[model samples]
Target: MNKRSPLDRHKQIRARLARRLFVVRGWLVLETVWRAAWPVGAMIGAYFALALLGIWEQAPAFVHLAVFGLVLLGGAGILWHRLRRAIWPGDADARRRLEESGGARHRPIDAVFDAPAMAAGASVLWRRHRDHMAETAQDLPVKAPRLSLVYEDPRALRAIVLLALFIGALYAGPDAGRRLFQALQPPFGDAPRTVVLDAWLTPPDYTGKSPIVLHGPITANKAHDEAAAPLSAPVGSMLVVRLNGGRQAPVLLAGEDDIPFDTVGTVDHRLEFALSDPDLSVLEIRQGGRSRALWPLALSPINRRASALSEPPLKVVGKPCG
Candidate 1:
């Protein structure tokens, strides 16, 4: 077996050390970035959570502007404060760290690249010392980067923010993404106009049945395609309709008649009618001459049956009894 020359041995040692230095430098940069930007990440997560929960929509325009500005300023301030004193690891710094990471006391990595003095160049002891340092540098160990920010955030606020974001996302359903985008829009922009309609069927007092909700805040879908099931109500039940936030008053279409809603307030309209006609099969609500809702009506006739004595109270003529 041929042995490696001193020059080849030096090259091998330098190559191994160079690779370790590269890795350590990368890890140092990643650690610095994490420490500087984690706070911003946490803030963004909390903001998104609120948006998903629809808190932004309920807040006023001024509140929206204030919150948006606060997030930007706070994020910038955090990044600047954390990065101002950050010292990026250079090649030399990485090399030093790599050597110290292995708990070496002899400073072997430094000695391998150092040139011997003129007086020490001829000494056999110096050559042996250099050989030992080169051998030690061959198997240097690099530790994983210190990326955790627990020391900076002793309260673990990031975890809490992540939890809130997760819960809000789940509660928001498939509309969470759209809501998030909406939350980012300018507060002064023209918002979409929505009309609210509430309709219910209330049975007469003698029927003793609870009112049935035909349309309400939760079931109001402008794009719903599936036809609503026919509603079965006792005869004489009152059909109450309340429309709010519409540009025009809503009208009730029963058979061929066009019944208009009574104006209650500037934007509120109400309609109340008895479901007495058995021939009325369908009811439709219209606004601006466009059908908003349709409900098939099935009126159930009131049950009225009289009880009669079956056998004339079981004549006891048998025994005037003992």
Candidate 2:
């Protein structure tokens, strides 16, 4: 029986590395998609829910979210390709070490990674390396390594754990979760450095209202001294402004006789203010006198749509005076 040469053994190792490289790269992409896809989906779902719940139906907001999701995924693909190529399987030195774990006892696979399809014109140095491989071949009966150097990696369990939690929270109360999702968004302007505000604008149950949250409502660190959206309620109607996650002192604020905001709590302020007159009001969040945020309030007549026109056709009593 003819003995197969060391070249054959080296070739075999290279082939194995190539195959293993594919495995590693595929796993990386799978892991990245696994981690990125769901959160993106959750965010999009939450945004849709908020829109349906009458939070804000501006198309641009959803457009920005879609662009962001595509960008994240596109960049992930580019990074995955780059990372895969970083491992040069063609390097004979690397291949030898790879097989070394499989029982290539000596550094016999030195040029395994660098060797060309066939070693070109033989120099003394080249011949010496070749001769070493040839001699080493005698020891390798089948050149099959005892164990594969590469191990398979799967999706991260930690990410999966967090994903489960996020999903649970999302289902438990989508409206409540909407606030957190909002904060995760990129701030529009130069937002505050470290803090986040999760505010919920809950409509009064009498108004058949459910809770709607605005996460990262104040994304900009230095936000305008005004509310993002106007809070409108008819006279005698109630509005609940629940603020969470702020490093500021809270005070039961009264805005100059403009229907006092009888709020609750200090650190995390939950301002439950009632409407009386058809006047404007504001809810300001001030902490350390540095961070300040405002929420506008609009009061409507007790019967917003109720009018004399609805009571009875207008009376032409003016003619009697004439």
Candidate 3:
């Protein structure tokens, strides 16, 4: 077997120590970043969750501004506090830490860079000491850095915030991100209350048909663009309109007449009428003097002849009439 020369052995030992030092340095940086940024991340997540759940939209403009300011200030303060106490490990510090973790009793890593004294006998001693240190460092242990923020959040509030964000995202559907941005904007006047408009056609009990929804609970701004399909219901069916949480009562415009909705509550309105007008070809719902939704009505006359034909023919049971 070819034995390594003293110079080669020295190079190998130094290289190994350098790699350990690099790892320690990286972990130190990572720890510092985590400690400083975790609180800020948690704050941001909680804010986003509220936005996604539409809590901000329901609040006044002042409340939105207040929340924004609080988040900004809290984040800044947390970062400043954590960063002020953060210690950025230098090369020497990294080397010391690595040696300590490896359970080195003597300062082996320091000896690697120590210079020999000028005295003649000191050179031999220094060389022997470095060799011993190299031997001890051969099986050095490197432990992973402590990156958990459990101590900072003892009550596990961060986990709750994460859960809220997930739930809110699902509840908000595809418009989750859009709702967040909308919540950030402080409205000029009082925040617009969410309006729910539900309108459907209920066929007569004799017709044996389920109620057909003409418009689901859509917001006021999108009602016109998101109108449901044209309504085709049998004549004598009842058209029911329910408007909830709107500032003004809703109006039903069928043909030329404008029928006002009956008050149901402080902000609830309901209208129900029989669809007997065969000439009526369209229906419209108006709120605050603006058309919210329009549906083309196609009323089909009941077919009595078809109903009769669907029944079994009268049975002629009389055996061979006389």
Identify the leading candidate in terms of lDDT.
Answer: 3
Which model, 1 or 2, shows the larger TM-score?
1
| Whole-model lDDT, model 3 | 0.77
Query: Distance (Å) between predicted and true CA of 108, model 3?
Result: 1.7
Which parts of model 2 are misplaced by more than 4 Å?
Answer: 1-99, 105-191, 194-232, 250-252, 256-269, 276-280, 295-322
Evaluate model 2: give its TM-score: 0.33
Error of 1 at 234 (Å): 28
Per-residue alpha-carbon lDDT of model 2 for 154-249, expressed as tens digits?
Answer: 444444445555664554353444444543563343333233454555543445556555443443343443535666655555545554433344
1-322 in candidate 3: lDDT tens per residue? 9989977898898888888889999988888888788889999899999887767755656787788888989899988988888887799878777878888877888787566566876777778878888888867878899888888778988899999999999977765766776656645454444556788889866566799987533433444543545568888889988775445777888889999999753455789989988878878778766566677777988667755665678986767757
Cα lDDT, all candidates: 0.76, 0.47, 0.77
Task: Rank the candidate models, highest lDDT first.
Answer: 3, 1, 2
Q: For candidate 3, which ten residues in a row score worst on lDDT?
A: 216-225
**RMSD, one per candidate, in order:** 10.2, 15.8, 7.5
Residue pairs whose backbone atoms clash in candidate 2: 91-113, 92-112, 92-113, 92-114, 93-113, 191-220, 191-221, 192-220, 192-221, 227-294
- Report the lDDT tens digits of candidate 1 across residue range 143-255: 99997888978999999998999898897776576667766763654343245678899986666679999863322343442355667887778999887544467788888
- Residue 26, candidate 3: alpha-carbon lDDT: 95
